[model samples]
Target: MHAFVVGVAHYPYVGKGLGTGPARRLLDDLGQVTVPEPSAREIAEWLLTAPRQPDDPPIGTVEVLISAPHPVKVRASGGAPVEVESAVHENFRAAFRRWLRRCEASRDNVAIFYFCGHGWRHGDQLLLLEDLGEDPELVLANSVDLGVLRARMHLTGPRLQAYFVDACREVPMDLTLSGSRPRALVDVPEPDGPLHPVDAPVFFSTAMGHSAFGDGGAATPYTEGVIAALEGLGACRKGGQWAVTTSSLAAHLQNIIDWNQVGEGNQEVRIEGQWAGRGVLHSLAGAPMVPFRIGCSPPGTPLPERVTARAMISPSPVSSVQVFEANQGHLSAGFYEIDVAYPPDSRFTGDTILWQIDPPNEVLSLTVRSRLPDRS
Candidate 1:
């Protein structure tokens, strides 16, 4: 697999805090961010250290670019840390070309692209590079038109392509009134031959006209959710093996965002383009562990101090038991018989709850009902 990743956090010309300059004055309304650089580095680390099955493709090349106040370094598997390039327009274009060339070496290769930074929506998504607004006359000279880039990717050799855009889709007021659109950094001629058969899936961090969020000096919530999904949370039993497919990953991301309340409660991830339903992004050696919530029905029923929850694998002796802490825990994917026990003197009674712990649906809620009093 080949990957190209970019994170632009130091937009000297677009935001405040930097020295007063012509470029900064032209686009000082936008705010500066501190999350994209870390987010990009985290994604690159995962790509380098991600586990793969025997049949999976090995990591080929990873080209990363980050725009930050200081030099950024990343380490590959079994290698020393290396400095990455700045996410300037020239650097990004060069890195992209190199990544595309590497991916073109084989049609079976998987191509991945990720970008996190300030972005705007003007009929299409426009990703701002580090040098955005440097040219006062052409404010978008250093930006990329995401839609055009995706269309050009159709002419690439790789059949499976995944794109993650972790940026805002909010429309800039100036651009909205001016009706100006940004041009892509790179342009490709129309293909004379028929376009290649490509399954390109684009994952946007937020819905149209929405802004993505991140904690200052830390990775964004979207990036954290994505890494978690890629690491196994998105895997599902497919053809007798656990695999993380496009659909499963999407579902898992949404679940994580909602369950964790990662962003502003209204932020929603959006998926676009044609997805290969069975395209396996990652294959796991074993079943995925999923989080589960256990509670008694008839909400807030009083229970004894000594309560135990045991989850036994169906048709097998293998089981895991937690004493009182089973109200919330992680369980491996499978059909399980859950037994919750309460003290004899407690109003709540023990009950058996059957549950199917599945992947993608990482969080499962199981409710045990209390046995009624013996009126007879």
Candidate 2:
């Protein structure tokens, strides 16, 4: 497997004094971000240390380009930490070429691409690099045209390719009015030979004209979802083993994201392309631990101060009980007898609910209602 990751957090001409005159003003609204660099680092670390199945090919290389306010260092597999290249157009082109060459060496290789940073939509998705407005006349000279890149990837040898784009897809008015389009790094020519059949799935963080959300000093919400999906949350029992396929991963991502929202506006995840077959991204050695959520119904129902929730596995050799006071918890795939208790002083009652937790990242909201006294 070969992975290419790009994270741009520092745009020199966005809000800085890198470019003079009108070109810099065009990017006034696109400010510096603090999440993409860390998000990319986390993904790279996971790829370096993640366990691989016996039948799966080993990870050949993880190429990362990060643009940050200060120099950044990353640790490769079994090696000392080294400084990574900046996410400028030249560096990205060079690094991507190297990564693509490695993927072309083996037909059984898997190619993964992840990008997190400022982006715009103008008929095609434009991924901005560090030196976006470096040239006064050509503001988008350093951006990348993602649409062309996906089409050009068909020439590669890797049959399985996945792309995770964690950026906004809002259309910029300036680009549309000025009739400027971003340029693709690779020049794709008409195919002459039989193109290798590919199963490439592109996952976008948001829908068109929507902006992706992220907190300062933390990874973006979409990045967190992707990592969780990779860590067995997206796996499901298929044929005798647990595997995370393209379809299952997409479903789990939406479920997990919806469950995590707390009064925040919904972010619709958009997925493009389809798998040629069942594209298994990751396979687990055992049953996956599914996430379960429990809450009261009727929008803002009050609960007792001393409420307790317990889940006991059924038909098990040994008695096992998991207790929690929060509304969310993780449990291994099994049939469970859930019991909730409330304080006598409170006007709420408890009930025993039966649940079957089998799906990956399964989110269930167990609602306990209040018992009303009879007038009679």
Computed on alpha carbons, the lDDT of every model, listed in order, comes to: 0.78, 0.78
How close is every model to the real structure, measured as TM-score?
0.89, 0.87
After TM-score superposition, what is the CA distance of residue 125 in candidate 2 from its true location, in Å? 1.1
Q: Per-residue lDDT tens digits of candidate 2, residues 211-318?
A: 988889788888888888877877777788888777778777876676577568688889886466367788887877887766656557754333233444444424
Best by lDDT: 2
Q: What is candidate 2's CA lDDT for residue 320?
A: 64
Which stretches in model 2 have alpha-carbon errors above 4 Å?
16-25, 177-184, 297-318, 344-348, 359-376
User: How far is 235's C-alpha from truth in model 1 (Å)?
Assistant: 1.6
Instruction: Summing lDDT over every window of 10 consecutive residues in candidate 1, give the lowest-scoring window.
Output: 17-26
Clashing residue pairs in candidate 1, if any? none
